[model samples]
Target chain A: EPEVTQTPSHQVTQMGQEVILRCVPISNHLYFYWYRQILGQKVEFLVSFYNNEISEKSEIFDDQFSVERPDGSNFTLKIRSTKLEDSAMYFCASSEGLAGTYEQYFGPGTRLTVT
Target chain B: ELKVEQNPLFLSMQEGKNYTIYCNYSTTSDRLYWYRQDPGKSLESLFVLLSNGAVKQEGRLMASLDTKARLSTLHITAAVHDLSATYFCAVVNAGNMLTFGGGTRLMVKP
Candidate 1:
C-alpha cells in the first residue's frame, strides 16, 4: 500500500538555527497535516494544508513555523529558529478526503533534536 | 477547546488474557480513529469509527465508538506479546483537526 514518507529521519540542529522537515504524501492524497509529539507526550496537531494553503493551525504553530507544498508531492515544515523545547518527533500525514470523513495515514516521522 | 483522554495509561496483561482501553472526548464528534505505535515507530491506523455505535475489528483487536457518550473503546482479546504497543484514539473537530488522547501503552507478557 502507498504510504506517506518523510526525509531526514533524524535531524540535529543547534538552537536558534533553522531546519526543514520534508514529506512526500501518499500519491493522490489531497489533504496534508503536521503533528508533533514531545517525548512521552500525546501527539499535538501543528497545522493542516489543502490546496497549497494552510487550512488550520494550532496555537503552537506560531510565526516561527511555516508549511509549504513547493511541489506536487513535496510538503515541508520549516522552523525559522529552533528552541530546546522544539525537539520532538514530527509526523506528516495525508488523507484522501476531509479528516472528518477519511482516515489519515501517518509517515514514519522525523525526530528533531535541537541542542 | 477539544480534549481527548484515555484511561489506564499503562496496561500489563498475560498472553491469552483480555483487556479494554477506554477513550473519552470532551466535545461532540462523529469521527473517531484508533492507531497503534510501537517504540520509536510510526503510528499505524487500526480503526475508523464514523458514526454512533460504529464498530470495527481486525485480528485480535476490536474497537467501538459511541458518539452520544463521546466515548470509544479498543478491546483486545486473547492478547499476545506481539500486541505490545501504545494505542491512541483521536477525534476530529469542526476544523478537520484531530485531537489525540494520551496513548495507552500495553505490554503483553507470556
Candidate 2:
C-alpha cells in the first residue's frame, strides 16, 4: 500500500527563523491536508490543499503560515517566523475522492521543536 | 459549528474485558471515521462509517454509525495490551474537513 511520506522526522529551529515542512502525499490522492497536535492536546486542522490552492484553513492558520504544492508530488508548509507555540507534531494527510466518504491516509508526522 | 464528543475520555480495563466507546456529534453528517494513534505517532485509520446503521469490524474492534442519531460507537471485544491507544472519531461535514472528538485513551492492563 502507498503511504504519505514527510521529510525531516525531527526539526529544531530558532524562534524567529523560517522553516518549511515537506510532504509527499500518495501519488493518486487528490486532496491534501495539514494538521498539528500539541503535546497532550487534540489534533487541530491547519489547512487543506487541492488543485494547487487552499480549499480551507483554520483560524490558527494565520498570516505567518502558508502551504503550496510547488510540484506534482511535493506539498510544503512554510512558517515565516516561528513562535514557541508553533512547536508541535505536524501531520500530512491525503485522500482519493471528496471528503465525508473517502478515508484520508496520514504520514508519520514531522516533530517541529521551536526553541 | 460542529462539535464531536467522546465519553469516558480515559479508560483502563483488564485484559480480556469488553468495553464500548461512544462518540456523539452536534450536526447532521452522513460520514464518520474512527482513528487510532499511539503516543507520538500519526493517526491510523480504523473504520469509516458512511450512513445510518453502518457497521464495520476488524479483529476485536467493531464500529457502528447512526447518522439519524448523530452518534457512533466503537466496541472492543476481548481487549488486549496491543489495543491500548488513543482513539478518535471525526465527523465530516459539507466542507470535507473533519471535526474530531476529544479522543478516548484506552489502557489495557494484563
Candidate 3:
C-alpha cells in the first residue's frame, strides 16, 4: 500500500535555529496534516492543509510555524525559530477525502531534537 | 476544544489473553480511528469507525464506536506478543482536525 513518507527520520538542531521538516504524502490524497507527539504524550494537531492553503491550525501552531506544498509531492513544515519545547516527533498525514469521512495515513515521523 | 482520553495507559497481559481499551471523547463526532504504533515507529492505521454502532475487526483485534456516547473501544482477542504496541484513538472534529487520545501501551508476554 502507498504510504506517506518523511525525510530526515531524526533531526537535531540548535535552539533558535530554523528547521524544516519534509513530507511526501500519498500521491492521490487530498488533505494533508501535521501533528506532533511529545515523548509519552498524546498526539497534538498542528495544522491541516488543502487546496494549497491552510484549512485549520491549532493554538500551538503560532507565528513560528508555516506549512507549504512547495511542489506537487512535497509538503514542508518550517519553524522559524526552534525552542526546546518544540522537540518532538512530527508526523505527516494525508487522507483521500474529507478527514472526517476518510482515514488519514501517517508517515513514519521525524523526530526533532532541539538543544 | 475536543478532548480524547484512553484508560489504562499501560497494560500487561500474558499470551492468549483478552482485553479491551476504552477511548472517550468530550465532543460529538462521527469519525473515530484506531492506530497502533510500535516503539520508535510510525502510527499504523488499524480501524476506522465512521458512525454510531460501527464495528470492524481485523485479525485478533476488533474496534467499535458509539457516536451517541462519544466512545470507542479496541478489543484484543487471544492477543500474542506481536500485538504488543501502543494504541491510539483519534476523533475527527467539525473542522476535520483529529484530536488523538493518549495512547495505551500494551505488553503481551509469552
Q: Per-residue lDDT of B4-106 in model 1, one digit per residue for the tens?
A: 9998899999999999999999989979999999999999989989989999999999999999898999999999999999999999997678999999999
Kindly report the fnat of each predicted structure, to 2 decimals. 0.84, 0.53, 0.87
Q: On residues B30-96, what C-alpha lDDT tens digit does candidate 3 reach at each position?
A: 8898999998888988998998999999999999999888889999999999999999999889777
**Candidate 2: segments with Cα more than 4 A from true spot:** none
Quality of candidate 2 docking, DockQ: 0.65
With a 3 Å backbone cut-off (N, CA, C), the pairs that clash in candidate 1 are none
Give the range where candidate 2 chain A is weakest over 10 consecutive residues by summed lDDT: A96-105
Residue B110, model 2, lDDT: 100
How many residue pairs clash in model 3?
A: 0
For model 1 chain B, give the 10-residue run with minimal summed lDDT. Answer: B89-98
Per-residue alpha-carbon lDDT of candidate 3 for residues A5-100, written as tens digits (9 for 90 to 100): 999999999999999999999999999999999998889999999999999999999999999999999999999999999999999999898845
Ranking by lDDT: 1, 3, 2
Shift in Å, residue B80, candidate 3: 0.8
Residue-by-residue lDDT tens digits, candidate 1, A42-98: 999999999989999999999999999998889999999999999999999999998
**Lowest-sum lDDT 10-residue window in model 3 chain B:** B90-99
TM-score of each: 0.98, 0.97, 0.97
User: How many collisions between residues are there in candidate 1?
Assistant: 0
The regions of model 3 sitting more than 4 angstroms off are A99-101
